[model samples]
Target: MPEHCAAFSCSNRRTIASRARGITFHKFPKDKDVRKKWEVALRREGFHASDTSVLCSHHFNQGDFDRTGQIVRLRDGVIPSVFSFPVHLQRLEKGRATSSSRRAEESLSVASQDSQEMATSSPQPQPNDVNISTLNVIS
Candidate 1:
């Protein structure tokens, strides 16, 4: 059987054309956690990567590769991040990301307010006090 890409909707296979296009296949990581992350990134419901399962280079950012050697390799802990997910899956991912980012922004805002309140409440300049306004201006 011809080896094929395991990602959903991916038609890449090991062939001369694919090689010419710089498409390389990567095996699922041996570390269970990293492997699971790859599977989740695929967004295929209930999908589990078998030992022989592979994802194509098309599903990863160019930065994900380590090319110091003649052979290309995925950097340790790298998870495939690119995909052409269906509209419904894309919408779901966007919704989740939006909510998560909103929560993160809220947390950062609250922290900033707390820091400002603490700074204002201090009547005396601390020995360690550096001007935040000056830092902001320099930035």
Candidate 2:
């Protein structure tokens, strides 16, 4: 089986075209700390990198690689940091946003309440709306 990029939305495969495009594939680092960082960058909950798992160059900055040698290699201690994760798949920063699980539930509940209010509520009369009958007309 062809090795595919392990990133969530990346579809890059281990093919000649990919190589030709200068997109080098990299294996997860052997260092436990570095490998864990790579896994976290993937934003894949409960994801663990297997022996064959790889991430494409597209998920890393150019500086992360060492291209001075004949073969492209990742610089020591570097982690994959570049990715185009969708909004929903993005992680919320601690203390900056609500937790993902609670955010979805809260948003849905708020939306439902807003819809209900819209359906039953009439537009309030503006201050400019006058009851002509209540005004004494100067004949």
Candidate 3:
């Protein structure tokens, strides 16, 4: 039987797809001290792990995986410290944007199309849109 993730709200199980994707299930540390540390990291309340309990690879960092040879593996004594849990909320400001951001180039193209339609539709703003008070004050 495949082992399911022991993390709270995570049900990732070891399967063919996961193995193909190089995602493996991690068994809890055999040493009692290490196991205690792992429990602290997982931070699950009122959950006790059995001998067969495991955690999925999603909780681990990319650096924890060793891909030097043909097959990828976890480095020995590599405790999982880089758990993302769900996701990291980040600001998508102008200069802080990442390549993996949700913004697509398609939106920009659509905006350009709207701009072109506006150009062909009308060249001037409505009379009401102009600041008549400011203009009279300037005069």
Report the Cα lDDT for residue 138, model 1: 43
Model 1 per-residue lDDT tens digits across residues 1-139: 5678999899999888899999999999999999988988998899999988999999999999999999999999998999988887774434325878889988999999999999889897778999877675544
| Tens digit per residue, CA lDDT, model 3, 17-130 | 888886778788888887887787776766667899888888888888888997657777677665545543222356425654435665777899999999999867776697
Clashes of each: 0, 0, 0
TM-score of structure candidate 3: 0.52
What tens-digit string does per-residue lDDT give for candidate 2 at 1-139?
Answer: 7899999989999999989998899999888888999998899989999988999999988888889989999889888888889999887786425689688888989999999999779677789999888999888
Name the candidate, 2 or 3, with the larger lDDT value. Answer: 2
Point out the worst 10-residue segment of candidate 3 by lDDT. 87-96
Q: Report model 2's TM-score to 2 decimal places.
A: 0.64
- The alpha-carbon deviation from the true structure for residue 135 of candidate 1, after best TM-score superposition, in angstroms, is 34
Provide the global lDDT of candidate 1 against the true structure: 0.89
Off by over 4 Å in 2: 92-139
Specify the poorest-scoring 10-residue window by lDDT in model 2.
90-99
* Alpha-carbon local distance difference test for all models: 0.89, 0.89, 0.75
Each candidate's TM vs. the true structure?
0.65, 0.64, 0.52
